[model samples]
Target: MADLWTGMVWPVAITVVQILLIVVPLLVAVAYVTYAERKVIGFMQLRQGPMTVGPYGLLQPLADGLKLFVKETVVPSGANRFVFILAPCVTFILALIGWAVIPFGEGMVLADINVGVLYLFAISSLGVYGIIMAGWASNSRYAFLGALRSSAQMVSYEIAIGLIILSVLISAGSLNLSDIVRAQKTVWFFIPHFPMFMIFLASILAETNRHPFDLPEDEATLVTGYNVEYSSMAFALFFLGEYANMILMSGITSVLFLGGWLPPFDIFPFTLIPGPIWFILKICLVLFVFFWARATLPRYRYDQLMRLGWKVFLPASLLWVVLTAGFMVTFDLLPHH
Candidate 1:
């Protein structure tokens, strides 16, 4: 019994450590991403952002978090009492759950299931439920409208995103994220599938409800959208959830197209720097791209956004899928070594 328990103890300890690895960094990044966003946008618009909080506004997020921590929790008079409290929790959980299967580095995944990609897609899809519930439970037209728009937009782009992922999965012949990264050891998929990468990036922006695609939360129209009624820690949960999803999406992009945690090349003498560094670098780059897009692009008109997703990205991804299939068959790139 002692021997058996000893063998199991290390596995359980390792699992606890793995869970901490996922949760801790994510929480810290969520705080800092808000800071980074303010700084980046401030610089872009020729204004100072969070100058008073610590040197160069490094502690602005911390100050903001402290403020939210003490804010009052106000439940609206007519809302569904249960779901009104639960909606943000649901959104926050779904956001973090997707990270469970994401391989941060070589042999550093929390729960590397065989269907990791599928699990991500499914969990992401469930995020809409949280938005929908928040809107419906809020008993506000603006909130309802925002929820509806966000759901529709997310669903529309998700189809194209699914197709884009399908193309890569076909090329790599596996749904496991680690397998996908390993498949890119010789050459990343972005080279042959540049169009797919473009489509995927656009769809991700839409899915995450980021700027230019942030129609649901359009301040001019929806007045802060679904979480309009939320206050205090409830509001903070939604905020943290959004940033968590952003980081998770960036991690996915890194694993899929940026070689997961693999360094640029193995030629460097300092090969001992754990794979997590490369993963972090790639995620930062993707996040910067998100910030850059927000800084540069104007929001799309509703009709134009819908048309682009349905009429443009959908067809483009579909075409790429077929083209990739034909190329693979013709050139015999399938059965990838």
Candidate 2:
């Protein structure tokens, strides 16, 4: 019994520690991402952002988090209490779990699953359920309408996203994320698949419901969208989940297109930095684009959003997959294993 207990307990303990290591930093990053967004946008707009709190607003997220933590959670009178509560949990958990298979550096992953890409895709696809649940449980027509739009938008764009990933898979010849990164040792996939890289970036923006694709949260129509009834931590979960998803998507974009942790050059100064550091820097660059797009672009009309997904990205992605396969076969570039 002692041996059995020891065997089971040790692995579980180590696993829990690993998960905490990943999650704690991630939560902190999510908090600061908000600050960075504000600061970046503020700079872009020629305004000082968050200058008061704790030395150049370094502690602003902490303060905001404390405020939300103490605030009362106001559930709608008619809301289904259990599901309404469950919805944000679903979104937030799904967002965090997607990071399990993400490779920060060579051999530096939690799960290291064979089908990491598929795992990420499935986890991301389930995100809509949370919004739908919140919408229905709130017993509000506006929330429901927002949910409907979100579901439709996510589903439409996901097809294009899937097709784009197919092109990546075909080129890398592996679904394991580390293998995908290693496959790009010579040249990043972005060079060969520039078109798909661009499309993938756009698709992720739509996938995360970011600006220019945030019709579900459109103030003009939905008035704050599905989680409008939520307050405090419940709302914070949704907010945190959004920012977390953006970071996760940025990580994915890094892995798929920008060569994960590989340095721009293998020689001299580039090789001195660690792989994980390189990975983080890439994620930050992609994240900056997310903020930049929000500050610069106007939101798309709902119809335009749908049309871009179906008519533009979908067909283009499909065509690219075919083209990529042809080029691979012609050049004997198809990866073995």
Candidate 3:
């Protein structure tokens, strides 16, 4: 019995440690991603951001987190208490768990599943449920409407995103993320599939409910959207989940299009840096574009957003998938699994 207990407990403990190694730093990164977003936007707008917190505002995220920690969690009088509370937790957990298959460097991933892209797709699709639950539990028409909008938007864009991933998978000849990255050794997928890459970037922006497509939380109409009744840490969880999803999507983009941890070139300077560092730098570059879009782009009209998803991205991505398969077959360019 002791031997059996030790065997089970030891592996469980090690697994817990591995999860912590990924999650703790990811949470910290999520906090600072907010800080970086603010500072980046501040620069784009020619203003200082978070200068007073601690040494160029390095401590601002900590301060913001502490403030949220102490605030009163105001549950709506009519809210379904359990689901209302569970919603943000759902959102945050989904955001974190998607990182399990995201390889930071060669052979550095948690689950390393065969269908890693499918896992990420399913995780992202489930994210909308949290918003829907928040909207329903809040008992607010505005929140419900926001939830409806988000569900429609996310569903529409996910189709296009999935098709785009199919195109990448066709080129890479594997659904395993590490295999996808290794396939890009000859050239990043983005160069060959530039149009698909641009569409993917836009799709992820909508997928994360970020700028130009932030209709779910549109201040003009929805007044704060789905979590309108949430406060304190509940709200913070939703906030953290958004930034985390942004990073996750960027990581997926890095894996699919930019080559997960590959240096741009095999030259001396690029190769000297480690693979994980290259992966991180790629994520940061993608994140900067997220911030830049927020600073520069106008919010799309709801109709325009829907049209782009259905009429533009979906058809384009579907056509690309077909073209990619045909091209690979015609030219014998398919990577051997």
Candidate 4:
């Protein structure tokens, strides 16, 4: 019994505790981010947002979640029940598993893997699986079409994203995210690599299926698209996965460009606050852009989205990578990993 407790139970228990520490706060943040989106977009659209849910609609997410929890989960008679049920689970899980490598602050990551950037990219790329599964399982034309559109879009943007990340990796000279953040101590990557920064931002929007680039589930045509057959908790999981992915993408952007957890100038007012606070603020800034784009821009047609990814972003990012490397090599500015 003593041996079992020491060798097995305790480690498992401790791991669970540590996981809860990250997960609970994360779930809470996810809930409130939904609220923030509604509030921000509503303000942008000149309307009151969720005023009746709680104190200024503060409790709306909780209420909505509960409603979703109780609603009936309907599986189409023609659908593959197994894969239909598994799709959202896959989405929710993959969206979360990537967080393992994310460094929230100095020494604040769950797993400080050397190839953290690669891990994140791989997980993000795999997110297409959930969509494809959902589409095929649903046995609905609209869902299948939406899924195919999303898969193609994600793949296209990912290529540009890969090149942009390669540029950052070349500059940082390491695959570890913490090292990447610390590499920005002298000057944030965005300052020097502003063009790549912009490209990265645009790529992530398409990758995460954000507005203007969200052709997969274009409400006008697809009627909710790939998840059209989902309802109740099934739909809720997809919703959760999307918002979670948004936050994760924002975090990745901050880590890559905004100097994750680093004070702006290490000066009096800037360094006065804790690192995690700066990280959170940067995330909020990025997320606000997500909502802002939704409110301000119109949805793109699938062809336009494809053209932007392949013709515009792909070439631009590729060119910048070569230029960045050449410039660094010529100047002897490339840092050693």
Candidate 5:
């Protein structure tokens, strides 16, 4: 028993602690992200955002979180209890675990796996499952319709997203994210793959079901979509999961495009900032754009959204992948380091 406890329990406990370290701060970041969004959107609309709770409404998210935590979860009479309750849990879990592969700085990741990018991609792709499950389990027409729309949207954008990632992979010549970043030590992929970067950013927006392409959750249409029937902590989980996924995608965009943790320049002032700080600042920038789009862009009509992904982005991304490969092969730009 002692030997087993030392060998098995200790390792498991250590892993759990490491995961908590990553997850706890992420949850806090999600809270602040909501505050930031509200403030940004408010500024854009010429209004003051939440300014009541804790200075400048700093405590709004905390108050909101506490309210949701105390609120009783009410499952619809027609809902599938097991899956309905499980959906948000799964969504939140998947969102948190993606950070395992994310390196904040040198030797800073929880799991420095070789296939980090693939891991992130796979985890992100699975996010739609929770939404689908929630919709189907809710047993409501609105929920089901929303799920169907979300499924189509995610799949359409995913194809383009995959192709865009492939272009980066081709340039980096490695599936590992650290290698991908190191390859960008001199120049970021966004500079070289500008078109692909734009497409990728757009794809992630649709992928996260954010504003503009947020057809599933259109209040006028699907009646708030997959989590329509969810309330209290259940709804809170879905809410946190969405914001968490946004941050995760932002982190990914940072790695694949902006050069994760690498300063803009190697010179004095820029290089003086720590890599992790640089990494976080990049994420904040991307997230600001994420919120900015929500403030400025109107929702896309369903047909237009689908057409943009499949008709325009799909073909364009495919062609870009080909062009990228040809350029790299012709010019020998492959990462030899």
Candidate 6:
């Protein structure tokens, strides 16, 4: 028993270290993503971004965090205090938990479950409940309306997103994200299934409730949306949760379409950079695109948005699924190509 315990100790210690390694960097990245968003949007609009807190505003997120921490929390007089407190916590946890199954490199994952993709879908679906709770708990009309709109929008878009994911899964023949990346070693899925890639990108933006699909928080119409009543650190949690989900979606894009951690080509004898570098680079690029879209595009009308998701993307994704399935069957029928 003593020997067995000794053997297990190192493994447990290593696992803890690994978890820290992923979690710490993820927290830091979430902070910096906000900084990057401001800088990117500022540059796009020809305006100066934050520059005072730190050199070129590098430490601005820290300063902003400190400000939020110092501020007082206020619960609406007629609101359910407990649920108001719990809403942001739930969103933050769900946002962070989705990263557990995402592989950053070869055999580099916190938990590489076989049903990793399904796990992500389920976890993301639960995020809406947090928003709904926040809206209801706040006891405000704007928050309530935002929550209702967000729940409906997320539910509709989620179906299209699931169909798009199904198309990719059909092509890869595995729900494991790492396995999907491996299947794309010869050729990335984006190259062949461009339509699915387009739909996936749109769905992710909708999933994150970013601009054009940002009806829930439309300042002109819905004040500050579900988080309107939240202040101080409580508000910060929801902000962090949104950015974290953005990064998570970007990471998923890397794994599913960009070949998770496989370099452009495994040609060199000794590669200087680690796999995480490529993963980060890809994520940053995707994030930049998100900001770019925000800067360039106008918000879609609610009716048009629903029509595009239901009529356009859903039908397109369904066709792609059938098409991919047929291609797979034909390939299997033919000699190894």
Note the Cα lDDT for every prediction shown: 0.90, 0.95, 0.94, 0.93, 0.93, 0.88
Worst 10 residues of 4 by lDDT: 328-337
RMSD of each: 1.8, 0.8, 1.0, 1.2, 1.4, 2.2
lDDT of 4 by residue, 233-311 (tens): 9999999999999999999999999999998898899888989999999999999989998999988878888999999
Candidate 5 per-residue C-alpha lDDT over 1-337 given as tens digits, one digit per residue, 9 for 90 to 100: 8897799888899999988888998999999999999999999999999999999999999999999999999999999999999999999999898999988887778988889878877898898899999999999999989999999999999999999999999999998888888889889999989999998999999999999889999999788998899999999999999999999999999999999999999999998899999999999999998999999998999999999999999999999999999999899877775
Per-candidate clash tally: 0, 0, 0, 0, 0, 0
Superposed Cα deviation of residue 281, candidate 6 (Å):
0.9
TM-scores vs. true structure, each candidate: 0.95, 0.99, 0.98, 0.98, 0.97, 0.95
On lDDT, the candidate that comes out on top is: 2
Best by TM-score: 2
Candidate 2, which segments miss by more than 4 Å at Cα?
Answer: none
Evaluate residue 315 in candidate 6 and report its C-alpha lDDT on the 0 to 100 scale.
90
Cα TM-score of candidate 1 = 0.95
What lDDT tens digits, residue by residue, belong to model 2 across residues 107-211?
Answer: 999999999999988998899999999999989988899999999999999999999999999999999999999999999999989999999999999999999
Q: Which stretches in model 1 have alpha-carbon errors above 4 Å?
A: 1-13, 269-273
* Candidate 1 lDDT tens digits, 43-87: 999998788978988988889899999999999999998999999
- Supply candidate 2's per-residue lDDT for 42: 98
Span of ten consecutive residues with least summed lDDT in model 1: 264-273
Clashing pairs in 4: none
1-337: candidate 3 lDDT, tens digit per residue: 9999999999999999999999999999999999999999999999998899999999999999999999999998899999999999999999999999999998999898999988988899899999999999999999999999999999999999999999999988888999999999989999999999999999999999999899999998999899788889999999999999999999999999999899999899999999999999999999998999999999999999999999999999999999999999999987664
Candidate 3: TM-score? Answer: 0.98
User: Lowest-lDDT window of 10 residues in candidate 6?
Assistant: 328-337
